[model samples]
Target: MKSNILTIMKKELARFFGDKRLVLTTLVIPGLMIYLIYSLMGSGMMSAFAPSEDQIYNVLVTSPSEEFVAAADQLKLEITEADIGDIDSIKQKLRNGEIDLYVVFPEDFDQSIASIRVGEAPDEPLELEMYYSSTEVNSSAAADIVFSYLDGLEESLSNLFNINSGSAQYDVATDEDATGMLFSMLIPMLLIMFLFSGCMAVAPESIAGEKERGTIAALLVTPLKRGDLAIGKILALSIIALLSGASSFVGTLLSLPKLMGGDMVELAGIDAGVYGVTEYLTLLVVMLTTVLVIVAIISIISAYSNSVKEATTYITPLMIVVMLVGLTSMFGNGAPTNPVLYLIPIYNSVQCMNGVFSFSGSLINTVITSVANIAYTAILVVVLKKMFDSEKIMFSK
Candidate 1:
């Protein structure tokens, strides 16, 4: 029994790995593409978050006071005074990239501060409104700098009045919380994508390509049981998909520091060592079962198609659904507490991974998801076996 399955698996593996072009496109190219794409995205994010060193910021002020003007000059900002009525035009200029930011000081702004300094409170609090285009890099940087300057001004006024605002409070988030946030937000979605891409790369060729080339008819005539052939094909495709997934996984881990703004110490505010042995084990279990499910789905789709192109076309909708399901982690707080939801296949795997990463994992749900996935794959294998036995499916024109 084992010999037949092994023979079939070996045949599939040899057929895949023996071809240099297939190996390159399936294994090597995916990792390389992910690294390049993610690195470029990270670089773009970094550039967007900061302005160039030589960039000069343009500023417009309304009813500027002597102290405010001094502050602007100290910061080396180019200041222009516009009428309050020109606020709309200034905003339009900001949107058009003609200016970086605009600041508006309330009427009697200096008098309000004077009252406060003389130990008399004003009837209303003094207010300043700064407007800037967040979509523009220079505008965002200028806004941050101006906000810092305002904070300093506020601190100076507080010191002049001897006002005590109490001690500073630091962030209370622990390493675990940060790690959970990062993992829950990133890993589940990425895992799903990688698993699907891996399976998509190979499953079509294993099933649909063989059908298209009429090689499946040759295999069907052999002494191998139809069930054995189905299992062997699935098992072989799963292994290859797992390797492809692993390659993509490694690429993501290596480029994560670059992806998270080039800071390895902090990812979504979490440091390394957030995940331990238990977390890794949980991830392994979820990933393995998830791969099986993905492979089964792809294999079924490929078996139904007459050619690799048709197989891909059939699987595209499934890929979109998987991607959409993976995105739930981004918006959800964590895994759902309901155990019934754990039986929902791909969605369950995603939520379970999210739960495990966030420290909210339920062992019961994990077990259920794993078992359910295997059970579902078994049903799919039965369907595939039937498809294998059908002459119309195996040798379709």
Candidate 2:
């Protein structure tokens, strides 16, 4: 029995080693995919959150303290004194991610601290208001640095001053902007992945499975034009994939708020209703064009393959590319402003979605992305049609 088992294992090893594609799919692709995924994610996260070494944080202070000025200099923070009348404008700058930190010190803060150090206890603790946007990375980092120094100072001075203490909200990010930022970062990547998965499910079966079963031969013999057949199949597959993706998209939107917050009270203002029909329509357009491009690409791969399993194996690399493209949504400070970047397939869809969800989507960019995707899909459709016409590819073993 042991000899027989060894003989069988040797036969299996011989078969496995003989099939280069099988070996590649089974071993090489998975390791490569994992490495690329992790590398892309690490790079993306670092680029998104990591501050530059030469970066000097811009800080706006209302009532400047001499000691705090010294501390700011040491911290590499550029301090600009502003009048109380400029608070609203300064906060607007923060919201726009222009400046990093806004520090509002109590009038005569030094005097107040000096009196406290002289054994004079005030009626109430002086509050230092630090206004920063949670959505802005620099603002958040600066807030941390400034707050740490103030925290140490407070401890030394016996809690003479409070930092952002009250029922008032100091983070100037509105509920809508906060919600948009979160959604834009996550939804684009997820949406593309879902669309790709949808295409993967049906494309292989429709083309490769039919070819494997010899049913596609019968269709080829029919009076239908190859271009028409290609168009029909692609359109049908795109619609089906869109439906599949839509289901996941809707479900994600519905459950996202709950995933974000634990309770209803915390999730009160975090509703998807912040997006109106225009935004939804914009998302729908992006998804529609994106689905067409995905379907066309998958169908071509499927046509080139002889079996469902082989088609799936062949498509794995493309799937990885799609995933990496989806990850571009997390790379920079919002979507890329370059109109030419919209000409690239898959990436354009992600950026368009990012813009719509983030409420900063340009109409020109959306138009460019849609047009480019449509053009790509058209070219892919032509290639697919040619593949359908080629007896060699369609009837491949």
Best by TM-score: 1
* CA lDDT of every candidate: 0.86, 0.80
Candidate 1: tens digits of C-alpha lDDT, residues 1-397: 5888899999999999999998998899888888888888888887878777777689988888767777775676788997787667878999998999998988788777777777787776688999999999888888888899878767766665544466753667788887888888898999899999999999999899999998888988888898898889889989999899988988887777777776554535665477889878988988898888889889988998999999999999989999999999887687889999999999999999999888888899999999999999999999999999998888777
lDDT of 2 by residue, 274-311 (tens): 89999999999989999999999999999999999999
> Model 2 clash tally?
0
| Cα-based TM-score, every candidate | 0.83, 0.61
Q: What is the lDDT, from 0 to 100, of the residue 39 in candidate 1?
A: 84
Question: Candidate 2 — which residues are off by over 4 angstroms?
Answer: 1-159, 166-168, 264-269
